[model samples]
Target: MPLLGLVSEYLGFFALLAAIVLVWKDSPWQKGTKVAATIGAMALLGAVLPAPPEDGAATVTAEADGKAAGGGSAAGVLAPASPTAGTTPEPSPRPRPEAADYRGMTLDDARDRAEAAGFGVDEHDASDEDKSIMMRLNWTVCFQKTGWTSSGTKTIDFGAVKNGAPCPAADGGAIPWPTMPDLVWKTWKTAHQEVAALGTVPGDHIMASTAYLNDQLPDEGEYDDWRVCVTDPAEGGDVTVDLRVTLELTHPDNGCPDPDREDGDRPDLPDRDDDGDPDYRDPFPGDRNRTSAFPNGLTGGSDDSSDGNGGGGGDHWNCPRTRWC
Candidate 1:
């Protein structure tokens, strides 16, 4: 109970005061005084600081058995502690932990992180309903409250659910938009490398969806028509990178809309759900029943995506419908 609350903070100043008086005041044992003061100062800090966090397994077990509520009726989950009679509220002086991405992690993992960051199991929210899905510690973390501003030693609380439970898609990536690179307009090839250089993974922090229009098919003259189009969460502030974004690609001649495009004219309409011919060109315009799929779109083949970086992706697909792969 001595270090459980803030009243013990004054003990530090008191120790400092006594140490200073002992070292600087008139004393026959001046040499011994300073050493003793140093040891005393260290002892005060050691005793006043909170103890290392208890093991996570123990805490979870305690909550499961209904002992962490600290009183009767077996509280459904950890209930906030009430102040003891005659005790003054304490000021927090402990350092907090740096920000972390808890998404896709397990509840037990999230709990361990919170505890290490100077938080107690009772200090944050987690209902028994949330824990009902713990199967070999596989309950997945779905939501978190902290963002880029988090720093060392600060407390961070997150929410979790069963592995298969529905978790809301992150509003954006875990990294802030300012921190993310400008990937728009860059070829699929270069974009893959950029994210990797920044320590992010494709399909994890980025995704690419490929589509080739009639003009993009082999029927047309060989040309570099496939390029990156729109991205989700558009480039902006405070945006957290969710998983990789889907980069829609089309041939330059296919006439996709582009705000950056110089001409103001809208491109011609597509086949409208019609199929392309054996030559890989749109054969049936505006006929949903006869649509065909042609060659697949390109995304810089290899294990790495992007036409520019590795420059060797030429995968094919079968399209008997409105669009090609």
Candidate 2:
């Protein structure tokens, strides 16, 4: 009935479309109106016609069962080839192909096979329209059933989208950040263990560094005698997932020399002007007239224009013209 209904709708719609198309070029009201009227009359006649009887279907079933009006074999019924008192019954046109054995196949392959075998395919998670339109095999079909059939109707069931959606966070698409555990006072070994337990690799996500890994990185093979002093966010702080965090460690009780400590040690360099200032330490190493430069007249060579005035921009009390105030 559904197929027949489709046929009726298609026929009527095609007739209207064909009429329009055929007369679209040289269309005058008379030709279009005539076509429409003819189609309308045909539709009316079809509606008034009597429906066909379903006797053919009944006759076929009766013949298959070997029954007739007078309690005898049907005229069209063929006797079993073996002339035995009781013979095995013949099979009907094999059941619309079975939908079983479709497991383990991708959703695309499964749908193709099922549909090709005379089953209508349907799916779930359609709200995720993006996932459904995916390469067809994007979501795996977990379960399926060959539904019941009666007369000429059938119901097929497919439990698809059991795998997951295509969007992020549905299948670990979004990065997950675990809270920075309290690894400050813990040993490097223990800290790494805790980081691993939080679903991050030690050497990859968490890095163990001896002071701080700045421009220069220390040897990758050295992590002994060092206690964790700092994590990027400290304890109880949240950090990005998979971001390599430097686990800065401090030497135990200052046992090893701390490279970051300021020991007042200075570098050696030549003083071209030799104004009691090393080239590296002197602000104006090349300028013989000035050993250092100062802004706002704080501490610089005396300015002669303001000298001996007892009130100058470079001197507070005009102490000397050759020196700072």
Candidate 3:
């Protein structure tokens, strides 16, 4: 039995004995009366004080109560169990997919495949022109890079060019810059095709001007009938789509003009002074004082007070005196 239970049992018995002794010795009564008083006091004390708990039973009961109150063991220590002790743990998410190669495929096919594999696709021009990919079907993938972004989103990038066009030698490499081709004497249509083959849009980069005098501006619809007479950047000059390239053109029937003559000269205009400049462009066509209408203040042959046409008005034909003429 526990020490506390034994001590309590002994205390109860002692209290009963003290009550008997007081009733017997302190009362001035007959022997029978004293005996009756002592017995009555004993019976009252027994009723008030409960019997001590049995040894083994008391220990077992205490342990059982401690457990019922959430104490861990017979020692009465508190349990440190968690609130979620019996529950199953949640599972982790699946891993992300890996990147794939997309070279040598059509842009449309490559995009579809990348998307199907859970990746976003971005495209770029593989040439120095930096043109946008308009028709996916018309462009083929030259190279590709696939990987995850900082946000963990799968993505792919493709460098591509028009079908049948060659790819750059390395990934993300730009196609070599093209040198201006000698398109002189070629039909406008042929010139346009050659420029396009070099990855340049003829309408955006190539311009045409009339090579003959008194001719109307050339039209794109009749480009097949016009022939190139001169190229702006000249033959073998470095060219790109961003540069403005102009071509001097004339009709096949009219034929090209002399390459050595001044740009705006008219074959019909007379040059009495034998200067390279035509009569209309020369400020002093007869005196040979000035060869062209170029504004270089007047040279020699002072103000003769006569116009080039033998008129009286002093140089009235040199209208505005600017280079526009």
Candidate 4:
């Protein structure tokens, strides 16, 4: 290509020389010399200029199905037959009975109660420590809350999996990610708002259960009674959060969530069969035959759990039977 361009340029110089010879014929300007010089310049340009190499090699690349592993499977590949317009899609699956309390309270239950009281259950946990129950509840909560169930709970051993999508608000409120109601959110909020007001030490300084203790009711009266030692100091550059919650009733009720609590702070106990440690025991004992459900710390009245935020509070249950740090 370069040599071609150079030759084309030198042709112009030859033409110029030819024109001068024609304009001043036999004027001792050496017409033959001019023609020879033009030809030599053209030859030099053609000799020195570069030329493009002929097309030869081609590149090859591997093709994939465009689907990532452990990602969207077959169903994800299919497109809808028609565009959706002026219509609503079918709702997601509601949580199963396994997701509900004995009192028939699912996130839907909480939502109904919240709506009845001019509010809404902002989010819920589709999963908990109980995998069997969680599996069933996952579908149920996902269905009823559809977009909101994604606020579902995450277990302590969260690994490399990308978190599920967040729960959209039923009433368009803020959505909390990674997990939902049941306990952690309520515990943190109560620690920041309610409990800390009583001059108790902040939970940011304690070693506590990261999950909710449902059957184990909250301790009340003084902050000192509920004080648990911080067994695990945070690692280097890690945040130190000590969560201690004491649920005190503004008014006592005989029909409180649980039966054993006649009117006092319930204690937590240990479960030996599950290979769980004494300090880290499951609060709600399904095999233990306990049944009671209360939202927030309210008793005798059907009130939606408002753990500071609109989401249901973690049902509190503490047992001196099993000491939790």
lDDT of 3 by residue, 1-325 (tens): 1232245756656766776677678877889998887777666555655566898678777777868688555564444555686788785653555667777889999999999988888999877668878989988898877666768787788899877566777855666557778888998878867776766444667777777554444446866768888787788876654567777777676667787887557343356776655454466666555555444544433355765565634454454434434
lDDT order of candidates, top first:
3, 2, 1, 4
- Per-model TM values vs. the true structure: 0.29, 0.26, 0.36, 0.15
- Mind giving the per-residue lDDT tens digits that candidate 4 earns over 109-155? 44455455433234433333222333322223332331223455311
Which stretches of candidate 2 lie above 4 Å from their native place?
A: 1-178, 210-218, 237-241, 254-325
Q: How accurate locally, in lDDT, is each candidate?
A: 0.50, 0.54, 0.69, 0.34
List the candidate numbers ranked by TM-score, top first.
3, 1, 2, 4
Candidate 1 vs 4: which has more TM-score? 1
Give the clashing pairs for model 2: none
Span of 10 residues, lowest total lDDT, candidate 3: 1-10
Best by lDDT: 3
As a whole number from 0 to 100, the lDDT of residue 22 in candidate 4 is: 59
- lDDT minimum window of 10 residues, candidate 2: 164-173
Candidate 2 lDDT score at position 240 = 42
RMSD of each: 32.0, 29.2, 17.9, 29.0
TM-score of model 2 (CA atoms): 0.26
**Which residue ranges in model 4 land beyond 4 Å of their true spot?**
1-29, 52-108, 111-325
User: What is the alpha-carbon lDDT of model 4 when measured against the actual structure?
Assistant: 0.34
